[model samples]
Target: MNEKKSVTRLDSTYMDQYDAHVERQGRKKKRLLRRLALFALLTLIVTSSLAIYHVQQRMVYAEKKEEYEQLQEEMGSLKESEENLREEIELLNEEEYVLEIARSNYFFSKEGEIIFKLPNEEPSY
Candidate 1:
């Protein structure tokens, strides 16, 4: 077996400067990569939050639209009911309508008036 002689490397000023320059370049590259990754993460979070907000707003709008339509239908029915009640009030304001209702339902009689009641069944001949 031939024994190999270990040649010692001599450290020079130029070699030291080159090593420092290489180390600085490596650190700069690592910093640039970290900044890029952080920027990408922030952009993803903002876009996802915006998308969720948009969906929620759309859902709220749909629910409000449905509620509005239901309210509009209720308003229409209430108006019809109000008109019917107003007509009834006008009829009841006359003395004749109250007299007729009392005479038919409560057996009320005017002077020399006779009352007769008949069954409400249909007769077959």
Candidate 2:
């Protein structure tokens, strides 16, 4: 009877140690789970922030592209105007073209030519 009681006591002590070990393991598992949840949340936040930043960058690039196209169109118009002005300058440098312009715009004639004068009508007011 004495030996049986000693064996029973020893079994109970071992069972208590086993239970403590299981509790420690459970606490460790809970801690690991909490760390994993925190890591996942942080990852989600970083990914979302990066996504938003990329979207904004794309929007800025699109606006700049539109502005560049507008500037290119204005440059084309300015180039055409510059070419027209250059041609006019070349024409004006020639004496014949200058004389033609003067004759047409000012009605100029060679020396000793007849001049016609037209009478103007009186104003009503």
- Compose the digit string of candidate 2's lDDT tens values, residues 38-103: 999999999999999999999999999999999999999999999999999999999999998877
| Candidate 2 residue spans exceeding 4 A from truth | 1-11, 114-125
User: For candidate 2, which ten residues in a row score worst on lDDT?
Assistant: 1-10
- Model 2 RMSD in Å is 7.3
TM-scores for every predicted model = 0.78, 0.75
Over 19-112, each residue of candidate 1 has an lDDT whose tens digit, in order, gives 9999999999999999999999999999999999999999999999999999999999999999999999999999999999999999999999
Maximum-lDDT candidate: 1
State each model's C-alpha RMSD to the native: 4.4, 7.3
Error of 1 at 48 (Å): 1.2
| Number of the top TM-score candidate | 1
